[model samples]
Target chain A: MKKWELKPAKDLGLPATERFRSLRRESGLVSTGMQLAWWSMVRGYMAVWHRLQITGKHHIPVQSPFIMVANHASHLDALVLASPLTWRLCDRIFLVAAGDVFFETPMVSAFAAGMLNALPLWRKKCGPRAMGQLRQRLLEEPCSYILFPEGSRSRDGQSTGFKPGLGMLVAETSVPVVPCYLDGSFEAMKPNQRLPRPRKIRLNIGEPVSFETVANQREGWVQIAETMERRVLELAPRRGA
Target chain B: MSPAARDRLFGFSHAFDNPVTLVVTLVVGSLLLLAPMLVWWLAWTGRIDRKMKSELITRYWSWLVITPLILGPILLGAAWTIVGIAILSLLCYREYARATGLFREKAVSAVVVLAIVLRSFAELDHWYRLFVALVPFTVGIIAIVAILRDKPEGYIQRVSLGVLGYVLFGSCLGHLGYLANDQNYRPILILIFLSVELNDIFAFIVGKLLGKRKLAPNTSPKKTVAGAVGALVLTTLLVMGLGSFVFRGTVLAGPGYLAFMGMLISILGQFGDLMLSSIKRDLGVKDMAATIPGHGGLLDRFDSIILVAPGVFHFINYFVGVGADQSVHIFTGG
Candidate 1:
């Protein structure tokens, strides 16, 4: 008889409160259902209200263990970037959200963890430990990530220099990092806006960038970040021309 | 629905009518009150270390909270009892799925959950045929759903795990809720729940004091042959003592019959615990989940009850039918 392959849940034994903030968090039926429902609603809202469109949709790979790094602009950037993927992928994709904002309170933490399926990145206290955990999860679970490498949302709709923190995840690994550009999400829902406006939004996915040759060090991370930033910026058309 | 059925379904007023319910309720209530005093005395006398004392206190507090939730529904009505069991079935299923990594198979898990809900409906409607039929029906559905994924590499593993999970948490545990179909379900249920829980306590205490010769060292290191025998004797006595009042007029009134039922409760209850132990041993986890403060998951606390529920239910069912005189198809009338 083949013995039962007993792989207990990765996030088992953690208390509920600890589960929300843990990097080892894994979605079960409830979180999967919630993410599906929430993402479906976001997809619908983007299609109707924002007139969302995606080019180079085929650029996003069908498999996981990849990072979807996009230019941070508005709150809608992550939603717009992640809303187009199939629900199967969406369930595994964790949006690396800011810990201070999304996870400060219990209610928001629940929404962020349950609906958005986000793993928090404590910018203030974010060190190698946090990044190492994220890196470990990406390789161990062989999961994908949707994160803004600029570290925070762009205030004036202009993409900034990509932070090296993104390197901490994909550097020295075979995991592909796909650079993406979000157009008009800033106009739709800026950082200060309480509600998003009905503005047409477009997503441009660039080719997958590999950092396998890049060293897993500070300099290599910076190189990976800069290359990804240049690629994402290249996806956006020149303004007014 | 008939007035009698309505009364049984929603009759909070008659909750205390049965002496078994009254005695069990009072006894459980008193235990809840007196446990803390015992803890404090032990702590005061410095009999237990701080860590052990803290763990015991935490366990007691959780019991204080859990006792009401378990009793409130039964006291309210059979309908509430069924609903409560449905919730428990769902929670237990969730814990099991997560532990076995079966929750990732969304389709099979969904079917399992759907089967559980449907069984709850059957119990509520008093539809015995559907309640009984759900087992094979769900197993077939889970098998089919597993194939829908189209990846056959680990197809057998996935389907079998789903089937086992549904059988353990969904079908087996659901029998406890179905017991509410009996007109005198409150006391019958109280009796079963009380004896099953006390059986665990007996085994634990006895095992601690007199336990030698590990029953199944690979499955459960702490369990002893001596403890198993002790629990069997004590639980059988407790059941016979308390069960006499509940089954006074039934065919199960005699000492011989009562003793048999008690022995079944004790033995089956221990087997249920061993079943979970085997699962945990295979999985190499201590507790199912850290849900309760001092205990493990709801599954850990209620693992023994899962098998005991069906065992006792069917045993009594064979003797004197459950809900024999009660109205059938209370909701979906033929």
Candidate 2:
């Protein structure tokens, strides 16, 4: 007989708040249910409120161990990107969110972790160690991530340079990074806005890119980030097109 | 529902109607009140160090919150008690699932959860036949739902974990909830809880004073042979003394029957503790989860009650029949 293999939850011993902020957090049945409900509601809201549109939907990978990187402009970017995915992927798809914004307070942390199914990234103190753990979880658990390579929401309508932290996750690995472009989110809900307007939104998903040959170092991370940024830029609708 | 059944379900006015309930509540209340003084005395006398003192205080605070949460439901009404137990069953199952990696199999977990809800419903409706029927029905459902994944690899492990989870958390703990169906459930549950908790304390205290030989060192390093025997003797006596009051006029009032029931509680409670210990050992974890501050997880604190619930439930049920005189199919109106 084969030996029984038991792998306990990675965040088993952490307290509730710490568990929310930990990169090792894994969603159980309750959180999964909550995320599904919340995401389904978000999907409906995006469809009705924003009249969200998608292009190249078939470019999205159907399996795990993939990364979806898009330009960060508004609070609704993650929601918009995740809305197009199938319901089966709801539990496995984690929106990599900013710690200070999403997990600063206990109540906010609960909402972010429980409803959004997000894992925290402490932008101020994000070191290679944190990135390494994220990379390991991405490949080991074979879970997909919805990331904004610009690290934070863009204050203005223009996108920012992609951060090297995104490269650290996919570099020297076979995991595919799909670049997506989101339009009209900035106009709908800017960083300073409290509420969103009913502006039409569009999402264009580019083909997935791999960084298997890229080194897991400074230059390689930069190269991966630049390549991803270029791919996302190529998907954006040209001016007055 | 009849007035009697109504009183048993939602009648908080008669929380202290039974003498046993009153006495147990007072005793638990006194213990909670006096605990702080005792801790202060120990700290002043320097019997325990600062770290140990702080740990004890943390545990006390946790219990301070936990005791009210537990006693409130039992006193509120049978309906609340059953609901509380159902919630407990779900939480315990969640911890077990996360620990054993069983929650990953969403289909099997959902079936187990649904079965537990159904068990709670059966208990509330006072439908014994359906209550008994659900065990097999759930097992069958778990087996069927597990195969839906169509992945043959590790099928046995998944099914076995799901079944074990259901049996331990849903079925065994469900018996405790079913006890609330009886008219005199408040006192009976209080006695069982008191004895089971004191059984652990007795074992720890006695083991510290006189324990020399280790009992299942690999399973639980701290448990000693003396502790097991001491708890067995002390808990049995506690039950015999308390059982006479709780079971007053029933056939279970007899010393012989009470002794047997007490022994059963102690033995099964110890076994339950050992069972959890074995699980933790196998899974390479110290505590199930960091739920309760100083005590580890809810499972750690309530492990003794799990097996004891079913054992004592059946023992009493066979002798006197639980909820025998109560209205059946209260909700369904059959």
Candidate 3:
């Protein structure tokens, strides 16, 4: 079945959220084995991230309808985020990814959309068009959006400041901007390394500061960003939910 | 000779020569051959996608057809066809490695070499004694030696750990040792191979037509109460009546025993298939390695062998009347 409605975690009940992502093109009519497989994948990835001890989850909206701004640490940041949030949120969360990166092949896109539920982000000069579409989705449906705060990935995997559009989107939505700092990913699969090591990583989620606060107070976003930076530093060493 | 007539006149070649071998091979080879057509028919009807369909045919059906054709009356090698299983186990392990990320890269070369070494020795005169001791001792030594190397950090541990999967996954191929050494090796192997395939076919045909009740939806969603009984009844009658002609004196101890054994083998085969499916479920993969068209991998294909082996092995052990400690005197039938 084709679904027109993009639902947020807040709108969906816990079980409903868990089941929702499993919906494919043949969503309702899939085989029993496939359905089992979908849910099992969702559960397994979440368990792995949870076992990695992602911290500051306590700071997230038990239900998220906010702008999640994090540094781009690795190619698999989407999956890493998916693995944890699929467990944490009570609803389906969407990540904004560069369209070209994942859309080259047909089956690949279908599968990513089906599994990751990722929405498109534009890296091209006219990226506003993609952001515009995202803006509409957020307004029409109660949705949480994950944004890579840094426009481009930091060469060294350090926490860099906001990309212009991310800050702009944060201002437009007035949603809480939760800064998440990730540690150990750069070392695990360094840019030069061909394969990833199974290294422990921490996702440091900070207390949500409203867009209004950052806009009204000069340097408030930076303070909020600093608070986030410090929080990730604190969260990195601890292995917990 | 033209290929079709050659296939026909040759009676499908080496794997199905003797009357005992022919009957068993007919049952086993045909079922193996038919499985993919059924999958294609299922796919043609839009049951599975193009990716799954192609995967099923190439990975499973191609090997299934080619193995029996190339190996011939050696259809008994259902447990381990030379080029087919050797490659199949490697593919199965590749899927395992990819899914589990257990072995990493460093472990791949060493573990694969050891596994193939074991395969090369599969047809040795003393395969059973060699396999039983060699697998245990060689794997242990390899693990210790690989671990001691310390080629890189995390490499050795992963290599050493890979031995578990290599052994657990590849050991089923060792059933060839038992198959070869059976005094009535050709018939017994073919008989059991066909019986399992028959169990699957009967269960599917009967289950589809009559199954209304769920047997174990959690483990095997397709099976049903009616299907189970139908398989039991069909296999006992069909297998026994056929076995009487093909197996001759060893057909069955009696109708009662044949029915009992047939029913047990059906259940065992079903359980084995389901067990492998469950492993895929746990590991979050589909079709072990996409090696076979309809079947998943060597592990997937031989899922029944591990369970079926004990039953057939014990039955042979008891009938051959070898005391528990005695080496099996493989009844070599030409």
Q: What DockQ results do all the predictions give, each relative to the true complex?
A: 0.75, 0.80, 0.02
- lDDT for every model? 0.90, 0.93, 0.56
Mind sharing the TM-score for model 3? Answer: 0.46
Question: What DockQ would candidate 2 receive versus the native complex?
Answer: 0.80
Candidate 3 chain B, which ten residues in sequence have the lowest lDDT sum? B325-334
Tens-digit lDDT track for model 2 on A119-202? 888889889898889899999989999999898888887887999888889989999999999999999998888999999999
Q: Candidate 1's residue-wise lDDT over B119-202, tens digit each?
A: 999999999999999999998998888888788767888899988988988899999999999988898898888888999889
Weakest lDDT window of 10 consecutive positions for candidate 3 chain A = A23-32
Off by over 4 Å in 2: none
Candidates 1 and 2 compared: the better one by TM-score is 2
lDDT of 3 at A57: 73
Better of 2 and 3 by DockQ: 2
Consecutive 10-residue window with the lowest summed lDDT within model 1 chain A: A1-10
How well does each candidate superpose onto the true structure, as a TM-score? 0.97, 0.98, 0.46
* Candidate that scores best on lDDT: 2
What count of clashes does model 2 give? 0
lDDT, candidate 2, B1-334, per-residue tens: 8888888899999999889889888988999999989998999999999998999999999999989888999999999999999999999999999999998999899999999999999999999999999999989988898888788787899999999999999999999999999988999999989899999999999999999999999999999999999999999999999899899999999999999999999999999999999999999999999999999999999999999999999999999999988999999897
Docking quality of model 1: it rates as medium
